[model samples]
Target chain A: MEYAYYPGCTLKQSAFPLDRQSRKVLRALGHGLTEIRDWNCCGATSASKLDDFLEVAMPARNIGIAESAGFEEMLIPCSACYSKTVVAKTRMNRDPRLKQEINSELAHQVRGEIRVSSILEPLFDAARSRELGQRVSRQLSGVVAACYYGCMLTRFPLDVDLRDDAENPGFMEAVLEAAGGTSLDWQEKTFCCGASATVYDRETALDLMGRIFSDALARGANCLVTLCPVCQMNMDAYQEAYCSRLGRSRRLPVLFITELVGLALGLGYKELYLDRHFVDPAPLLREMERQQETEAAS
Target chain B: MQEQTAFQVSGDAARELSAEIAGRSEQPIASCYQCRRCAAGCPVGEATGYLTPDRLIRMVLLGDRKMALNNDLVWRCLSCYTCGTRCPNGIHTSRVTETLKQMAREERLEPLHPKTDSFHRSFVKTSLFWGRMNEVGLMAAYQARVLWSCLKRRDFREMRSEISSQTRFGLSLFRLGRLHPGWTVSRGRRELGRLAAKSGRHSR
Candidate 1:
């Protein structure tokens, strides 16, 4: 079980927890994730909105690198990176002329043979494996989590080929359930957190975050889980800002699915970087630890 | 309710605009019948009073090029694809928005949301320089741009509070080793630069 991992820019800087936990979980599952050597930014929304050529060229260059390295499958952890890379690959494969133009521009030629996939695909497969249930040292039955997919993971149904409904995805929930956790049915699972708009349009982003937090709370979720870095930042870091604006005191810890998976596998808190979250997940981890002890004693 | 004025499209401009969009997007805009299903699902459409996804499509179909290009909604779009995924007519509103945005940039049309424009520009500039995003550099440039705008509007208090809050949050991230003040250039920066320059020339 080996794949070339694309961590993208955010994972190295803002979303280190996602990067760390993802690596930890992969290693724990007996999988090897070799970082895509010398990868650049995926050019995300800004490049795509600004320049069509650069948008395709940026990701195409990285995919070309993966192809040149002889890796058939590349696993991208960040949803934005996954979306951008997958979209570029799909567009290039669809239009050979455009592909040739991009390849000519690139220093390395993109063969279009390598497959781009989200880290969730492999994680979900591992969860479905028979060994996953036996490896879960801690059952997270008491922790009710609302799985938030945000926009990129399942945005384009046909193009992305996600395993669940794009609007109401259940792949993350399925993975969580396999790790002995209860996944809450929440409406805001697929809603946008206003993304980069969080920087420019604070009010709208906060309003959107407020709606998501309230929905998760209303659905009786103890915490929120996300696969995208931006979503985690918006929900975790800005939770207090939105709460104060709405005049509410409630707070819900937001965790990356990687962190949650790492915890269920009996990884230590420090290794999972649980303290790095804006809204502390320590209390929740402690509660789960206490529950596990009581269950063992009973 | 306010009186609604009927929009009239010049025949030649309408045909040219329709042809141009068709040639670029390869999606038939004329197929859209003002169904408003895209509007119903769009998060920005619901949040903002203007520039609903349905209205954007209608404007393009009607050949209101100026209105379509000049509207603030073009830049404010999150590109979440909610409208695209839910469109009854198979029109991806976000893709339409992207095409309009690209046109807006090429035409040098002034954006209604200047901060978003600056952010996008700074983002591209940072990537081209480092072959990866320099988070610290991006924040510095963005904050400087935003602060200048705030000062021009005499919103000093707002600017002060925002900078302080962001700094505090940044410091926390810095403590956690999630942020750094230094640049980490990728090994393939030279190749990335070459690709970017080639793409830039191609677009022109």
Candidate 2:
């Protein structure tokens, strides 16, 4: 099946791996994804919180562009973008005035039907993913993964049904299992990493990150896997502040969901978007290499 | 960081809040074993001194009402559900905390700590009245609430202390320039009010 794709700004830039790996996995799984040619930014977090109309129209513009590109169901990998697009879709469907207002602002002009979905749900769609899970060449049995679903992914009323459970999501578990990893059934899975606040409030941000990381460590998780780019950046880049404030350096590797899936599919680490990560995955990289050497010797 | 306060909670309201507000499962509140996992996982609990999901449950089991509502712990929860995600018994601790906040609001009980609730409320109230949230109108309405509440208690001094120098500095940042003209808060409220009323009609 062909799915229209939106790689909102981050996935094209800092989180390019999410876009790259998503395409790789979708192609390998025998699904076709056609990206809208001239998609604009979904206004990320700032636009939605700043104004209601801009939030709806900004995302609707992409939906309009995607519709114009000849597709119905679109996949968004970034959690914020997923939230923005889905939330806007809900507004357009529920409120006619809002729809009329937002549609008027579009350039390419789309007055058609569109459905937006996060990469998580489509990955969890059993009919589409069972074969993909069976194709996993490597069994990450020892890899203990913690799934983090930061805010906006599930909180906003309009974007509520993106996961199995909005409050206590299990999309990570489904994706992790497909990638052959042992996931911790821990409570910190749905916690927020203080996403937008990290820009202006370091103290609060570090404190929030510290709490989540420490909890994951306590649960014996080896690495934290997140679907959102900002969540990955916060967990990966903020280790220094976490060390300074908490008085202990704790480095927990954060991997994008696509990167993890690619690894399970026996794809090279380089292609999995490993290099773009802020917290060097050198330790995990070395560990993966060591495992490979052992298998080769055997 | 502020020193942790000694707050006491009654087991009944804690359990009741869990049942009525937080929408905890109808099973049993006593099932929780104080694993401390809930508190450890909570996002808001990590930032604020007052909140802890584990302790809130303990308060309910022990029948600690004053501790639950008066300590300002209820407001600290971001309702993100990190605790419930891992809860073995599936108790929704976050929902329970929210119920406590709603109860506190209805009772006109003083909030345990200073918060942006007044600001958010003014935003909501203005939207209810005008179909949009005017930033200038919201700020002014919030100030009026602060002034009115202070006058009711005849304790403007206490109110003055609540608005710390740091908070004032933060407030100044919003005033640097016109940020928002208006918002759909008013429109949202109208729809929400209709839904609420319709739900009420159905239940009755």
lDDT of 1 at B26: 56
Candidate 1 residue lDDT tens string, A216-236: 998988899999999998898
TM-score of each: 0.95, 0.61
Steric clash pairs (candidate 1) = none
Give the TM-score of chain B in candidate 1.
0.84
lDDT of 2 by residue, A1-298 (tens): 7999877655654456778899998787677898876565565544422234555665666777788877878888888788778767777787787677555545555554777788877678742458767878875555678888777566653224444676677877877876667788776666678774444344666788887888888898878988888788778767666867777666778988778777878888777757655566768757766776687689
Model 2 stretches with alpha carbons more than 4 Å out: A109-112, A126-129, A289-298, B1-204
Q: Judged by lDDT against the true structure, how good is candidate 2?
A: 0.64
The TM-score measured for candidate 1 stands at: 0.95
Question: Candidate 1 lDDT, tens digit per residue, B130-198?
Answer: 888878888777888889988999998989987997798788777766785567677666776777777
What DockQ does each candidate score versus the true complex, computed on alpha carbons? 0.61, 0.06
**Model 1 segments more than 4 A misplaced:** B1-8, B149-162, B201-204
